[model samples]
Target chain A: MKVNEVPQDGNNFKGSDKVKKLVYAVDKDGKYTGVNTKGWEAESFATQQAWAAVEEDLKETEQQVKEGVLSPIAYFMQKCLMDLPLLAKHVGKWQWQVKRHMKPLVFNGLPAKTLQKYADAFEVSVEELKSFGK
Target chain B: MNSTNYQHCQHAHCESGVTSNLLKYAGMDISEPLAFGIGAGIFFGHLPFVKVSGTPGTTFRTWPGTIFKQVTKTLGVKVHTQSFKSVDKAMQALDDVLATGKPVGMLSSVYYLPYLPDAFRFHFNSHNLIAYGKQNGEYLISDPVMEEVSTIKPEDLIKARFAKGFPEPKGFMYYVNEVPPTVDFEYAIKKGIKKTCFMILSPPIPWFGNNAIFLLAKKVKDYPKKLTPRKAALYLGNIIRMQEEIGTGGAGFRFLYAAFLQEAADILQKQELREFAEELTQIGDNWRNFAYSAARLMKDRKSDLVSFDELSDMLYNIGTEEKQFFERLKQVKW
Candidate 1:
């Protein structure tokens, strides 16, 4: 059975790129889509390790952001925001449009579930979720 | 006369006073922080918007940094950051920024969570403060909650405003120095036009948050050429201003601001200085009464207030006044 993630649809510009990366990052033979329990169990440790590394690296940046030393929006756009396109095969127009809209507002509108996760993790509103948006 | 020498307002609760006493000397109804912030915003060539929230949200950045950026961009002011980790260092930064003759504003995020009406529960952002320079080292701040001006050292304000916890930093704030990029109103006008014309116009129903106003102004600029730049800019400012005041639970006051702007525009067109003067006098006198009544309503509904009705009414009025203003402008037999 597939584990439930947060409420997210591939509604952003970089979803395809993100999915591809996720597939590459997780799958050994580049086979994604349907996974068996055995496959899930096999990759669980690897995924956890990868996630830990990413999270650890991000913590330093998060500290800088909180200290007003850097803009997390800028950091996310430069790093993870672009990578989100690897997640899905098709990119929608509205996602790109929203991304463009957010550019002026200091966001690039990547369909990363991280901000929502951050919100959930912090027990704050989704809109109030500070993101390193990977 | 230096930035280090800046002072705060003399009003009660006048914490961050860096504005000139010129208004006070002129017998103006000067409220510290509020007047200072508005004046400083103007002096720095930006419009001020006030936001008061009961809590600070995780997603929301510091109010001063966010607003300083938005207002400066909207008004076509170029701002640069100066580093000052201490009060003395901040004072020197202020002096240096001002010495160059560029207008300056400061952003500070005070962490004081004063009890607010429960209705403001949705807002979890720090009370935002923006102060702009007047003459010499004197600056004014548009403080939303204080509703008054108080003069203090620029360093004190930066500390009081940005320092996170008690026993606040003895250092400086994140200072914002601004000036019209080209010092030419025509350039500013074109910039304003571009901003208004190229952005998405969010429906006025939600009432613009501070940054949203900048985007809305840009969206309006993208309207058809039949709406002249001057008209578009004026309408955009008035629209945002009215919407914002109403959003903050000042329905009656918002109406007056809207109506007075209508009358001001009319008078400007007619070149009827005498009538314009009289209307200005009347507005000045009655605006406070409107504000008082609105404040009382807000106080009563402090815990559960949102003015959807007032917002809709203002949108309706905007449509009417916009058409009238455009028609008058077109038919002016100059």
Candidate 2:
């Protein structure tokens, strides 16, 4: 793409006013030049769609949490964009142990230290995590 | 050891920019595109079995750290590299290096970096940046995708470096120790181009290289038949995001590579490579056209399997033409 033609239809770069990504385009002289673009239409759509999918999952997880079918750990895990394997690894527990913690009954009987581990992994407070879907 | 001499150039890709910036600081003049090309960073992979964010994995470049390793090795630059199992030790090591006034490049996760806008943050674990020094407890950052130097708090930096996932950073860090004053660009460029050609054309499986493009095309062709419309659109949108949104410098590094060929042509004075550069630019445009068409289909979501047929056809042509492009590049006389 030419420099002038480089699409600047900008997405506000995910709502940040400050950062602009660099794009390599040709100038009028047909020489390659580095130009900063706020964003482009195609990119913005893709990002939105991905985030939308995540949001949808979040909603479903929220519904499950409300029904007590899953524990708050599941909600926070999805909120953090982490899968069970990742959250388990981060918390230094086996996947099955982490999966067990996602059960509301199992999560409720967990000790404070256990809750703290999951909260720390998600970068949230224990209280905030426990308060999910309330 | 002081980083006062360091010049930060925001680049299309993080590792390539970090590679270029580090080389420039070492007193060698290397642009981002040149570093990317010399590092053989451009690539194509669409793995059906591997899932990223619930969509099939699609990568437009070589694995992370390959560019830095290959480019430095090829140029005989000495580097200090290490990975840490202990987070405290890692942060301490970073501080110790910064204390000596040397800048260090390291892997990070975009999700933990708050300096970036919310729109761009994700759980991507292989983002790269440079830590020049510590100031009032915040680490100075020279992220390649950002326009200028920024700072990150120690806690956030720690989280970024330690983000748990595939390709985990594990607090991996490196810095250039020495760079030769005089180097051979002609040889490096030729090697870079050759490596790229081999990477694209020599992979034996359909999950990688040019063959992967056709593999994904086949998948796209079946998306409407096999998956929900939303799912199909998500799969295609993920492709665009990987190709255009995630900073391949446009057209999944096609434009960046073209820029490198143009620069290489100037250095080697190869009129033939210049012609190849122009041709690749057109090819890059075709890739953009593919993205535009795909995005339109994704937006409408009303089109039938026939539209899917056309989209897959466009991608099939891209794969075929790209295969031919590399083959011809492999035959370049110099």
Candidate 3:
């Protein structure tokens, strides 16, 4: 790639702030040098698409929670990419107990100590975890 | 070592760029590609069993620290590396190292770094950068993946260094302790190429080297039937992001390797290696084409998206092409 050809359209970068990548460029002497290339249209586009897919899943999870079909734990576990075993490890709980806590009735009956454990594992406050995305 | 003597040059990959820049600062003239090639940085692996962020992990380069370790060892340089359990201790150690006029190389998480754009922030823990100096409460950072030098608050720097996740950095840091007066570039170049070829061609498991490419292709083909539409799209999107978005320089580090071969050709005066470099450049372009197609499919959700079969076929073709290239590369006499 040539220095003159570096992408300058920073608008394609998602979020309010602009992102730049260090790109390799060839000069008149065929020598390679690093140049700051701004705006990754393809990367931003793919990421947006991926995040949209994630949002769709989140919406479905919210609906399920609202309907009492599942508990907030299920939504958070999915969002954090933590399986039962992983979340269990973080919270120092058995996998079976973690799975049981996914039920709305069971989770609601849990003590504040258990709720604190789940909240700490997810890096959220107890209140936040109890009413996630509300 | 004068802090002013350290010149930061941007590169496609971070670790290799940091290694190259450190070498240059230590009075050894080395290019990023040369550092990458001699470091044996190019690699591939797709471990479906090892999940990263809910998706199978696909890597285009060797794990972090390999490049710097391998390159310095190959060039007869002495380096000191350490990881700390305590954040305060790590900060003190880093400051002490900088106080000696030597810049410290550090492993950090990208998510906590404030300089990177919000869109690019992820929980990747293996990102490499250099701490050249300190002023007030800030650490002057020479992040190879960025264009300009940036500074990080001490609190943020410590947080990045101690980011909790898989492959936790644990405040890992390294710096060169000794540099030889001269290096045997010819020998290092040949060794690097041979190692890369052998690793890619000869990994025993199906989930590694050239085999992993085919393995991933097969899994992708099954994804449409095995996964929901949304899950399938997310999987495809992650693959593209890993290949094109993060630190690949573009085309999954193929172009960087080609640049290394070009440099090797100049160093050894090998016409065949130059030709091979040009051929590799075309292969890199082919990889870019694949990313473009995959991205297009990902973005076009309304229309009939590109079939998983088509995407799988594209990966298979790339794997085959890469296999042949490395096989020939291994045979070239340096």
Residue B80 of model 1: what lDDT?
61
Clashing residue pairs in candidate 3 (N, C-alpha, C atoms within 3 angstroms): none
Docking class of 3: acceptable
Candidate 1 structure quality by residue, lDDT tens digits, B218-323: 4433433435433332333233223221122112122222222233334235443223323322332232232233233233433234232332333334334333
Best of the candidates, DockQ: 2
List per-prediction Cα lDDT, in the order shown.
0.31, 0.89, 0.81
Model 1 regions more than 4 Å off: A1-134, B1-79, B82-104, B110-159, B163-183, B190-194, B197-334
CAPRI band for model 2: medium
Per-residue alpha-carbon lDDT of candidate 3 for residues B261-316, written as tens digits (9 for 90 to 100): 88999899998887787677667767666776777776674445666788889899
lDDT of 3 at B326: 94
Worst window of 10 by summed lDDT in candidate 3 chain A: A10-19
Q: Rank the candidates by TM-score, best first.
A: 2, 3, 1
* Candidate 2 lDDT over residue span B142-182, tens digit each: 99999989999999999999888998999999999999878
Q: Which DockQ-derived CAPRI band holds candidate 1?
A: incorrect
Report how far residue B134 has shifted in candidate 3, in Å. 2.4
lDDT of 1 by residue, A1-134 (tens): 11221112232221111221111011232111211111121122222223343455567656655665654542343233122221111122233443442342343344556445433323345554454432
True-vs-predicted CA distance for residue B256, candidate 2, Å: 0.3
Candidate 1 similarity to native, TM-score: 0.30
CA lDDT for candidate 1: 0.31
Q: State the TM-score of the second chain for every model.
A: 0.34, 0.97, 0.97
